[model samples]
Target: MSRHLLIETQGPWAGRECASFVRDAAALAGGGHRTQLLLLQEGVLGAVPGVLPELDGYLAADGDLLVDRYSVAQRGLKQEQLVAGSRLVDMDEIAGNVLDAAVKVVWH
Candidate 1:
């Protein structure tokens, strides 16, 4: 299976597309692809519980959810406030993934 790096920088509050994008990622993972959803900037808001219900399905399908540490601090979000299994990562990690030849990067 191929790997996909789906980078989301906006939250559902920004528009209706965020939730759809997450669902797409979940579908990809459910289809046996290695899909990772990286939430950065205002996208971290989606990491909050109940913000994006699609997150649960995404995680259940073995999709990885990565939240930006800097964004969390900048927005004053607590560690416990994020969704379960969500990983707090640095830019270095994002950079590494984005640079990986096996990863297909998509920013939304």
Candidate 2:
């Protein structure tokens, strides 16, 4: 069976907690699971260019990377400011769709 992982985090990517969250998401995706990362609150910082290069490999592996549009705007960041592979999504859309479909969800 295919498993879906939804990882939600809210903080700067430099923190230990954020790093672990990214690591765990990548590891799970590497193990062949379908993984999606949702960056909210300060966690949207991870979507900033050069903030989290580790996520590149995961994206290359087909993992989905999303940044909350509200969070980006709250931080005065534009869509273009986000990393190349990251997509901007509404929190409601995530909750109604991705979250509902995910087999497991992790928050950090």
Q: For candidate 2, lDDT tens digit of each residue in 1-108?
A: 465655556565446777677777887788888788888888888888777777777787778898889888988999998888888998676776554754677667
Record all residue pairs in model 2 with backbone atoms less than 3 Å apart, i.e. clashing. 11-43
Instruction: Estimate every model's Cα lDDT from 0 to 1.
Output: 0.96, 0.77
Pairs of residues at least 3 apart in sequence or in different chains that clash in candidate 1: none
Q: Which has the greatest TM-score?
A: 1
How many clashing residue pairs appear in each of the predictions shown? Answer: 0, 1
Candidate 1 wrongly placed segments (more than 4 Å):
none
**Candidate 1 local accuracy as lDDT?**
0.96
Best by lDDT: 1
lDDT tens string, model 1, 1-108? 899999999888988899999999999999999999999999999999999999999999999999999999999998899999999999999999999999999999
Tally clashing residue pairs in candidate 2: 1
